[model samples]
Target: MKSEKSKNGLYSHFRLKSSMSFLMALLVFVFSCSESDDGQMQGPEPVMPPETSMAPDMSMFDDEGGEENRVNTIQNWAYAAINVGVYSSILYSHLIVPVRAFKVTINQEAHFNEDAGLWVWEKSFEVPSRGTFSVRLTAEVDGTDVSWTGYVSKSGVFENFVWFDGTSKLNGESGKWNLYESPENPEAWLSNSWEIDREVGNGNTSFTVEKEGNHQGSSITYSIEKGADYDRTVLINDVSNSNLVEVQWNKESKFGRVKSEAKYGDEMYHCWDEQLQDSECP
Candidate 1:
């Protein structure tokens, strides 16, 4: 009987140990499920570097000043061309190279900017030869106002060079132009040559003449008239020598038609359409 009782005790002890182990496993599984149901597992958040505190560089602004200077240079040259054209036209109209005496009136006030070193003037006047002429002048000032005056002879020589008080961007510019008959025939009176100089800068930004021509047919007359339809008409007639050229331009369309007839050539017509395309006379 004692032996049987000992066997029963051993079996009971094994059952209790197994039951305790199973309960422990069930509790562990339940804890894992609860953690899974609660969104994601919690941990420390990642860190980022501190923000910087520095100012931006300002060297880019310097280029703007340089660009403005370049624009001023271009404006100065453009104005110079206008002034030269006006003076040349006047000389041609009078058939006088010396330009003994003349008067110029500037209707618009001279545009002067002391800080930017810029000056601009625009005006229109009448010339005996050119009929009516308009002019514009822009100048750059280093210390004083820049100006120049020159005279061209009938034989295409530059004389009486005069420099104004100021410095000019075209100070050293010089150009010569000649119109000859043809490459082979040298004997021709229907040709002329002229030279001009802008007594400023490097003097290389102008036209040059390699040969001279001798064409003295007759005095050329130029007339510019404004039309009723806001159009402009330029008539160049040398009727004494059988040379005539007429140009008409629309103000809004900016289209132009040119008809030219010369003593030595056939009649030619050209047109610039509204789209700024060049075509046969329309």
Candidate 2:
């Protein structure tokens, strides 16, 4: 009987211990599940996607209606009208002759006028930018090929007289003389002749004492040197009505060459050959 009682007590003690361990494990599992649920609720509020910045469009500037296409016409300058013909010959590739000296290039529609004409273009040109440019002029004169080389020094200024013969000697006298249409080949004239107080006489050519009413002072007598060269130039005593001066020039061509007659206040200057002419400046 005592053995049986001992065995029963041992069995009851084992059963109690196993039931307590199971209860502890169940409590731990419930607490762990509750903590996991709390962590999930606290996670960062669905991160609002970072706001993206948009770039402004440039489509408005690309409009074709507002576009402008400019027209460009280029005038070439083949040479720079230096005051010296020797210099011009060196600078220009063409032969420097007495005939092809003073000239300038103009646009096709331009025409030269005698009145208030100070080497200007009849029609103006629009320059795209300022820079040195090559200039050339070509014209068929009676089937003869005539050409000139020059340059455009200024963008706004029209290409005018080359600094050949006329510029060689007469930078001071430039703009003081007038260029007119000549009856013949050289095709230009200068007027305004007067008599000076200085006595200039030659045995060959006679200066008749006559009243020059337009001259502001007393009529003076002076003679130009008599020769074939002098035959082309007319002697004058005054030019500006106050100063005594001599006017000398010939007709446009070699054959019909005669001393130019001054009509008082009119002075002649060579347009095409002024660059090859003698310099009045020392």
Candidate 3:
């Protein structure tokens, strides 16, 4: 027979042990059902922009084609190409260098922010054409879109210029990009808003550039599509007058056509030879 004091002590010890076992089992169940990243998981990075070759690389319509080049001929293609070239200039001169800098993930490092649940890429890089720049890219999940932003600070120059921002599908089927004016032109910084929309799985993209804040007379839409007779097709919309300029060309043959009612007075397609001179359509 055990003493009363010994029995009481044994009872208390077994009771405490049973409570501990139940507490541990409850903790195991909670953690099993609700596993958290605890701020350690790396988020997804942004996708690289569509190819810039989406813009046609054609010489200016200065000589040869003349007035016929100006209108009523394949010159409509020249005219539309001219506008696209302008937007290309803005992108290459002010915005492209930074985008090219951090897009490569091979050597770039991405830091994950647990609090914000974002993946940030920052780097200082030099372009042979342009000087060095500090570029930062951030990406986070937003509904069905992966929201991303790009900020650039030139070396020994201005800091924190939000050169661009946009969102893409998590699977990268499509997206839109908004570009701002360079910090050098502060008066128009963020005043310039251009939109880029990518077609789903078709390898095509359309860019609409708004002039000043006006979309009536000066807006231009440039798009690229794959074609049958031609390897590539380009469509440019003169949004003000609701006119469409279409260019179809073979990449190797370098022959193409331009069709527009605003420029040619008819929707008939006009052809240009390999030399980009006026020719009869087939």
Please tell me which predicted candidate would have the highest lDDT against the true structure. Answer: 3
lDDT of 1 by residue, 153-255 (tens): 1213322222111123332222111222222332321212212232321111111112232223432222223343414443444333455555455656555
Worst 10 residues of 3 by lDDT: 187-196
Q: Give the better candidate number (2 or 3) by TM-score.
A: 3
- Computed on alpha carbons, the lDDT of every model, listed in order, comes to 0.34, 0.26, 0.59
Root-mean-square deviation (CA) per prediction:
32.8, 39.4, 8.5
Give lDDT tens digits, candidate 2, residues 66-158. Answer: 112111110000011111121123212222111122222222333322232212222222323433333332221111111222222234544
Worst 10 residues of 1 by lDDT: 48-57
Residue 55 of model 3: what lDDT?
A: 27
Residue-level lDDT of model 3, residues 43-97, one tens digit each, is 4555544443222233333344565555665564465456455545655555566
| Least accurate 10 contiguous residues by lDDT in model 2 | 47-56
TM-score of 3: 0.64
**C-alpha lDDT (0 to 100) for residue 17 of candidate 1:** 92
Q: Which stretches of candidate 3 lie over 4 Å from their true place?
A: 1-49, 52-77, 94-111, 127-130, 184-201, 211-224, 239-243
lDDT of 2: 0.26
Ranked by lDDT from best down, the candidates are 3, 1, 2
